[model samples]
Target: MARSISDTGSVVRAVRVWPVAGQPAGLPDSLPEPIAAVAVPPAGPSWPEHRTRFAVEVVGDGASGWHAPVSEAVARLVVDTLADGVVGHDAAAPRKLAYRPRASRHHQGAHARQAVSAVELACWDLASRVSGRTVPELLGGTVRAHVPVYASALGLDPAHPEAVKVAAWISEQGFWGQKWPLTKELLRQGPVAVARVLGNLREAAGEGRFMVDGLRRCRLDEALGLLPVLADLRVAFAEELLEPGGVAWARVRAAGAGVPMAAGEHAVDEHEQTRLLTGGAVDVWQTDPGWSGGLARSLHTVEVAADLGMPTFPHGDRLWAALALAGACCRDKVPAVEWHLTLEPLRQRVFTDPGAVEAGMLPSGPGIGLAPTPVITSPLPVWTVGS
Candidate 1:
């Protein structure tokens, strides 16, 4: 046996940490009882001793890419921070070695963005299988061929029956666009009581065109008094009204507000999404690729909002990594991609290779491009990397 190259780069090539358990593959495992937890760090006493929490089902294939509905202390802090910092590097350089601060010294929360988004999506499915090309042509190709999605309408009280079974599965699931998130007592019952609750959510989105987050909860006179009743209930945009550090956000963009004023989801990188595109407070940028620090910083905020023409909209769990980075971006600045239907069916039932996201596009399929449908009713125990 001849060993060279500095003793095979100083050995260190053994990984097999396991601790699997299952209960999340897709819709209806269970959860709906005033269920709302976000406890990140509390209960002092120097916490860390495997407090035990559970959830999983973020699978992928064509090589590797599965961060399953994480938790179990986010898969043991991503397999103990990738077995102590990315198992000896070069796992295809995982986003240039996990953003190098010495691989963020034992990493941080959200299991360090789900172990750097599951080893940077399995190092981009092993660099699209060594350049055979996929994963959006190694992240800089393809522009369309579908990829539009937008459902995200979690439960809220429209007389809660799970909000009429989540508005009848977002109007019989041919999803295209939808949004929720409006609690501040429903914007303080102003603007004609929020235009009679946007006319009962435009009759539960029958024709579909929803979207009205108001995540920050408004206040520029309550988003200019709910913008002329959400432009007479057309209501398709207005997310995060205002609250991401501002310089008046172009004075809430001249208080026109006929609609369209989305915001970056707690952004903290890409130079704050180029300062929310130089303070226009976003005409639409809703990012959150693991909170602006993954998917190459949400494709560098969709290439700086497609060179300031502004039109990016990603904020929703890894829908195939935001539809494989919005199908290689630049389609008039990324038309859409946001889906949390029934609050993420355990990350959309493990994707066993299949496709269907109607209205708002996303057709194509196969390898690193939509084709999974794993909805295992129950089966858990299979974490691996080493016993």
Candidate 2:
């Protein structure tokens, strides 16, 4: 008889949260500094210059698992409140151990969700290590050997004169596709200019090889105007073209424009996801496990979306979880995952090789495969709570 997860007797023993200092890493000189679609004043010192990210680790009887880079506040929340529920529970049953508000009275907001997500991921890692299985294996054995990924050019300005060259280079790098933000600045250049830039990029990257992100920076009218141009360029999809929850209107307009729409990275809970699905707002769903709850909830969302004939390309904010889902789920359901070009390297600084992408695919590894290295020189956890 096979041993079950409950048979392992690996209950959670400790949870630690800490800040990790960012370090400078080499990036391609040809690539320009990435910029935000909506420029806002800096809240504090920038990355690699200060301690900007946090990490979480869960310890079981004889195994440990870790995840990184959430906000310090989230880390503190876990240490102060959430860790208590996690400490004596079955580490292998992450869904049951994950934090949830006591009742409807307690507000369930982004911070709570993030806190839950971090703790839950650490639990999954701990569970995987205790069971001597990878997260995908624990979820259910992988359906594919590797998960395909797309290069997300979050900071690369699409309006640059060399944008065409950059697109060609990305395609040559073996990414399944590339996604660039359709910024307000680019849209201000007028429809003709937008068409020219997208046309050049499409020609450079080849047909069906690129996507665009509106980043919810566009007015509904502005997004509507771009639909025809996107369709004409044969762009793969237009992601978050308008503000979230404008579902019904977006669905009608998108259907009329003959362009596929995508959204849901900000839909962090079931209410939001249900609205998108019931409204038939998008052709593609892009849930982020880190924000939507954890691997378990996000995977459930993927299944529901697939049943409705919607495919998911999970947002890359939490690369490991997204990769795990993509690897384990049906290929037709989870076609690929986003790989943010500017953010991933910085995020992976604390890990050995957990989220490395090669030739547009993520290679399989044990557990969540994220363990902090000496590179994380933080002397001690900012906070810790144990059973």
> Which candidate number would show the highest lDDT if scored against the true structure?
2
Count of backbone collisions in candidate 1? 23
Backbone clash count, each prediction separately: 23, 1
TM-score top scorer:
2
Candidate 2: residue pairs that collide: 134-367
Please list the Cα RMSD from the true structure of every candidate, rounded to 1 decimal place. Answer: 18.3, 3.9
Write down the lDDT of every candidate, Cα atoms only: 0.56, 0.72
Residue 92 shift from truth in candidate 1, angstroms: 1.9
Taking all chains together, the TM-score of candidate 2 against the true structure is: 0.88
Following a full C-alpha superposition, what root-mean-square deviation does model 1 have from the true structure? Answer: 18.3
Residue lDDT tens for model 2, 126-151: 77777777778888887876888898
Residue-level lDDT of model 1, residues 91-185, one tens digit each, is 33445555433323644444565555544554454445534566676676766657767776543454333353554456666666677666577
